[model samples]
Target: MAMNDGMSGPGSNSLKGITFLLVDRNEALLRSFQETLASYGAAVYSVCDISKVKDVFKEVKVDVFLADMEATGQETSALIRSFRDSNPGGSFFLLIDRVTYKDALSLIGPEADDYFFKPLDPDRFAQTIETALGQSRPKSNSLAVIEPYVEQLKPYLIFRSPEMKQVLMNLPRIAASNQTVLISGETGTGKEIVARAIHVLSRRAEGNFVAVNCGAIPDSLMEGELFGHEKGAFTGAHKTHRGKFELADNGTLLLDEIGDMPLSLQVKLLRVLEEGVIYRLGGERPTAVNVRILAATRIDLIK
Candidate 1:
C-alpha cells in the first residue's frame, strides 16, 4: 500500500501531493490559497514579497507556479519573463481579473499555458492543473517506448551483464546522495536506463523527468534548448520561453550523448553544475534549480 505523508491541507482532494507556488502581492489571498491547497495535500509556499519570490523558488520544488498578473503590469511581465527564461522547462499558471484577462494574454503570450479568472472556479482550476500535469508526465516505465524484450539500453531497460551489474549496485548509493555521476558505456548498453533507474529510486521520484540529446541539437541552438531563450534574444525568438533545465528543475535531467557535446557548450554546462544555477541564452540573471542529473555517453569522457 502507498504510505500517506499527509502533505494535503483542507479542501484538498486526492491531488494534494503536487506542489504549487502561489505568488501574489496580497497577503490575505496568499494565505487563503495556501490553506485551500494544503487541505488537498499540496505542499504550498506563499510569497507576497516580490523581491524574494525568485529566492524562494530557488530553494523549493514548485510543480506549478501561479502568479498574479496585476502586480505592476510591466514588472509582472518582466518577472514572468525572467521566470520563463530561467526555468525553460517548467509550467506556469496566470491569475488575472476578468478585466485584465485579454491584456494579460496579449502581454504574456504563449509562455502562459493556462489562466485563471477572478472569482475562480475551484473545481475547474484543480482540473486544469491536473490535466496539465498529466499531459507533461514522462514515460517512467521502461516499456513505454521499447518492447518488454527489446533489452534496449533506453528508458526502461534490463541487463544481466557484469559491467551493468556493477552500475546497478552503485546506483542506490549514488541516487541517495548528491553526486555528479558520469555514465560511460557503449551504445545499446542501456546507459539511459541506468539513469532512469537512479531517478526512480531517488527522493525526487514523484517529480517530473526530462531527457535531452546533447548530440541531436545544433551547436547554435543547444544552449537555448537546454537553458532557454528570452524574447527578442534572437531574430526568431518571438516570445519568452523555458528550457529543459528549468522544466526539470525539481526532478531529473537525462543528458544523453554527453561525449558529443561541443567544447563551448561543455563549458556552459560545467558552469551550471558548478554554480548551481543558470542564465537564459540572452538574459543575465541566474536561476537556481534542484535537479538530479544523469548523463550517458558511449565514448570516454576524459579522452
Candidate 2:
C-alpha cells in the first residue's frame, strides 16, 4: 500500500488530490492558474524562476508539471523528454502561445500529455489539467515498490565476514531516524543501494528520494542548482527557481561526492545544515526547508 493522500472537491471537474508543480516567470499568471487549480483541491508547489524546466525537480515530486514552454527557455520536446526520463510515471503539460502551437504540437508529439495556449480559457484550462491527471491514473507505488526488492535482496544480504555483518546489522537502526548519515566506500561498492535500503525502512519511505552527484554539475551553476535563485538576479535569469535543498523538502537528498564540492559551496551547505534555512543567490530573504541529507563519498574525509 502506497501513501496516496488527496481529496477532490465537490464537483466532477475537481482536480482534487492531484499534486501540481507549476513553472512560469509570470507571477500573476502563475498565481491565477494556481488559484484556479487549487480551488479544486490540488496540492500545488510552484517556482516561477529558473531557466531550465527540469531543474525544478531537484527537491520535489509532483503528479503534474505545468510549464511555460518558450519563456522558460527549456524547449517543449526536450523538457518533456528530460522530465519523463526522471519521472516516467509523471504527467507533463506545456503552455505555448497560439502562434507556436503548431510547432509545439509537432515537436512534443506523444512526449507531453497535453498543451494549452496563452490567454487560457479558464474552463478549458481546468479540463486539460483534469484530463492529464486522469491519464496518469495508476498512481505511483513510489518507495513502497521497493519493498519487494528489499525482501528479494534480503536472502543474499548476509555477510560471512564479521566486519561486513556488523555494518549490515546497524544499517536498519540508522535508517530509523532523521539523522544525517555518512556512507563511505570504494567505488562501485553498492553504497547507493545501501542508501536506498535505508530509505525504504525509514519513515520518509513514502516521499521522493532525490540523488545528485556533486562532481557532475559545473561550479558556475552549482549554487543556483542547489540553493536556487530569483529571476533578474543575473543577466540570463528567467524566473524564480528552487534548489535541490528545496526539492528534497520532506524527502531524502542523496549528496554523492560530497568531498568534490567546492570550498565556497561547502560553506553555504554547512550553513544550511547548521541553520535549517538557505538564502537564494541574489535574494535577501532566506527560505526554510526540511530535507534529510544522506551523504556519500568515495574517499575518507579526514586525512
Candidate 3:
C-alpha cells in the first residue's frame, strides 16, 4: 500500500524516516497495520502471503518486521532464524491473538525482539515501537550496573582509560534527568559523541537530535541561527526560517564549543532556557519549545 499520504494521527511524524515490513494472513489486519504506521510518516510494505517475505526483503531494507504468528505456524522459528541470519540489525515483533498467545510463548526466543497482542491499540503500538527503536540495545542490568552502562555506549563510544570510565559512570543518571548538562573536555576528546550518547539514552531519543557548533558560525549570524527569523525580517530573509531551537523542539540540542559564544548570545540562550520560548526576529509573539540542552566546551568556566 502507499505510505504516508498526508493522514493525521497520534504522534505525528514520530516515526518519520522509519520503515516497516508487515506480514499477516488477514488482508484487513495488514491494511490496518499499514495505515496506522503510515499515518505517523513511516514507509510500510505489507503482504498477506508469508512466502513473499523474502522477495520483499530483497527489494527493500526494513528496520522493523511484524509477522503474525498464526500465519507462520510451526515454521515461525525457522523464518525468524533465517531473517535474523540475513538481517541481524533489524528488529522483529510477533503478532498473536489470545488463543495463540499461550502456544506462541514457546516461539519467543532471542530472534524475536517483542510481541504485540492482536486488536492492537494504535497509540500503544506506536509508543512501544518508538521505545523499542529508542532503546536499540538489548536490556541488561549487568552492563548498566557492573560495567557502568558501557554496553549502551558501545555503538557511540570506545574507551579503555580509567578516567574515561569514570566520566561515563554518571552517564546513565545524567541521561535520565531532564536538566541541562555541561560536558567539559579538551578538543578531540569525543565530547560530541558523548552528547550523542546522552541524547540516545534520554527520554527524547525518538525525537530529533540537533547539534550546532557555536564557534563555527559567525557571531553576527548566531542570533538568527538560534532563534530563527520571520519572512522579510532582514534584507536576505525572503522566507521564514526555523532556528536550531525550533528544529529541536521535543528533542535534544547540543551546543558544541559553547564557550566560544559571545556574551550577548549567551544571555539570549539563558532567556530561552528559562522561559522555554523563543521570539523569531521581526516577530511579535513567542513560540514555545520543549528541548533538552547539552552544552560542550573545551574551556572550564567553573575554574
lDDT top scorer: 3
Which is the winner by TM-score between candidate 1 and candidate 2?
1
Question: If the candidates were sorted by their lDDT against the true structure, best first, what order would they fall in?
Answer: 3, 2, 1
Residue ranges of candidate 1 with Cα displaced over 4 Å: 1-155
Task: Please write out the lDDT profile of model 2 over residues 1-303, one tens digit for every residue.
Answer: 121223323244367767778788888877887777777767777776644445666655567887777665546566667777776677777777644554555544367665555666544466545533442343353333223234634643544566555555555446544557889999977677777766665556777778889989999989999999999889888899988888888678898989999999999887776566888888999897767789999998997
lDDT (Cα, 0-100) at 130 in candidate 3:
55
Worst 10 contiguous positions by lDDT, candidate 3: 1-10
Candidate 1 lDDT score at position 18: 80
Candidate with top TM-score is 3
Instruction: Give the TM-score of each candidate.
Output: 0.49, 0.48, 0.53
Residues 1-303 of candidate 3 have per-residue lDDT tens digits of 001123334558768878888888888877877778888788999888778888877887788888888888887888787777767688778887655655555555545765666676655566557544543443543233314335556898876777766556556556654567899989999999999888876657778899999999999899999999999999989999999999999789999999999999899888776567899998999998878899999999877
Q: What is candidate 1's CA lDDT for residue 131? A: 34
The digit string of per-residue lDDT tens for model 1 on 1-303 reads: 011223322454645558777778888878777776666666777777667767866876567778887764667667766667656666677787744654654544356654555655444455445433432353443322222113322446454666654565455445543345788878887777778776765556677778898889888888899999899999989998999999998688999998778899889887776555788978989887666678889888777
How much is the lDDT of residue 224 in candidate 3? 95
Candidate 3 residue 267 Cα shift, in angstroms, is 1.1
Note the Cα lDDT for every prediction shown.
0.66, 0.68, 0.76
Candidate 2 residue runs with Cα over 4 Å from true position? 1-149, 152-165
